[model samples]
Target: MSHLSRTLPIKRAAHVYLVHEGQLLLVEERMDDGSIFYGLPGGKANAGETLGDAAVRQVLVETGLRVTDLMFVSLIEGELLTGTRNECYANFGRFTASFSGDLAPTDPEVVGVKWVPFEQVEGLVRYGPPPEVEERNPLIWVPTRDFVRGQPRAYYPI
Candidate 1:
């Protein structure tokens, strides 16, 4: 482990890969700089909450969807850097989830909810899994396809 890993705080997040009919569920938000950002329907886990529970709760709040049968697919560990300094370590748990319900965003930060076509996802999502993670685990990040359910979970460090 590097010095930063030993010194920096860790932030644990849970994100879902909710695919239906070749489209993925995405939450659209406006960043501080007024740029639009598209990301998965989940967020950081709350205190004392399991990652799976966080995933379900975040999905419900962000997309009005009830998710179930979560299958763990990947774990991505990376540093959230501020220029040359390491700010915090990000540990993200990625899951493939089964969800039901219509699209409705309840979160105030969420400006919209979209079902992006699989092929268009890569170009649309500005904040995504790190490149190292995506390159090593194409099945998890590839824009045109979904990872197989029950596939062995993979770990990527960035």
Candidate 2:
């Protein structure tokens, strides 16, 4: 394997946009500085784990909710580069699922999990690595919000 190919590996992940009662279920993270951040309840796909399986496992782990009816929504592709290292990040699959169970944060790093109303999403302040060092991964996550809003969808980050 070439050094460049090894270093610039493809990081594949799957994330779920789970909705419940007109609100989107999300995980809340509190930074040490007391600032709060929110994210969809999913993570990196395990080796040999299909994106659908990973999405199910991650949501259960992070939010204590069981989900089903995974529907394909979008494929988020972007390259994250930092210094000499490059990560060809591919959120190759994205899905929406319906969930059951009381909302809670099973992961210690996740402070809280709750249902966020659609109107509140804009101010939620999505984040990514520093745009300069880390090639930006969709500054605005279009798949989640658009899905929740029931809007016509095309992929782009604002």
Candidate 3:
């Protein structure tokens, strides 16, 4: 078998949009450069876990919020890149979820949780969902949906 065949080429992750009272729930993360950015509460799926389950588990771990009424919204597939080389392919699922609880982040990588007003979200988010996806559901945001397919986008270390 070739070396490439032994390595995993595709990565799978899921993210959720939790909205309440015209405000969206977001997790604050400190980037490598020490700058902080806000993104949805979710992460990569475990080896045997389904994407929906991963979404629920990540939200609870990152924001201390129990997600209910989880609904899958969209699937974004594209190539991940490191400079000019293709690093991997990615499959990201966007979900809308309802939650009941206060903000209390447990993940060390997560600095905190904030409920940002809908009007301010576009300005604060670095990677917003694709235009087509946003048009269908303006309330949801997927951090990896900004790149076009067939074009390599920079790989983000989570």
Query: Clashing residue pairs, candidate 3?
Result: none
Each candidate: how many clashes?
0, 0, 0
lDDT-superior candidate, 1 or 3: 1
Ranking by lDDT: 1, 2, 3
For model 3, residues 89-129, the per-residue Cα lDDT tens digits are: 56678778878787788899999898887667767755422
Tell me the tens digit of each residue's lDDT in model 2 across 1-158. Answer: 12344445666677787765677777887765466777778888888999999999988889888988998887766544434345454545678887788776578888888778878865685455444422123443666656667872644322
Off by over 4 Å in 3: 1-8, 82-86, 127-158
Residues 15-119 of candidate 1: C-alpha lDDT, one tens digit per residue: 888988878888888766677777788888988988999999999999999999999877877765534343567777888888888888799999999988766
Better of 2 and 3 by TM-score: 2
Cα shift from native, residue 120, model 3 (Å): 0.7
Arrange candidates, best TM-score first. 1, 2, 3
In order, candidate lDDTs are: 0.73, 0.69, 0.67
Model 1: residues with Cα > 4 Å off, grouped in runs? 82-86, 127-153
* Model 3: residue 41 alpha-carbon error in angstroms: 0.6
In candidate 2, which residue pairs get closer than 3 Å at backbone N, Cα or C atoms, i.e. clash?
none
The prediction achieving the highest TM-score against the true structure is: 1
TM-score per candidate: 0.79, 0.77, 0.73
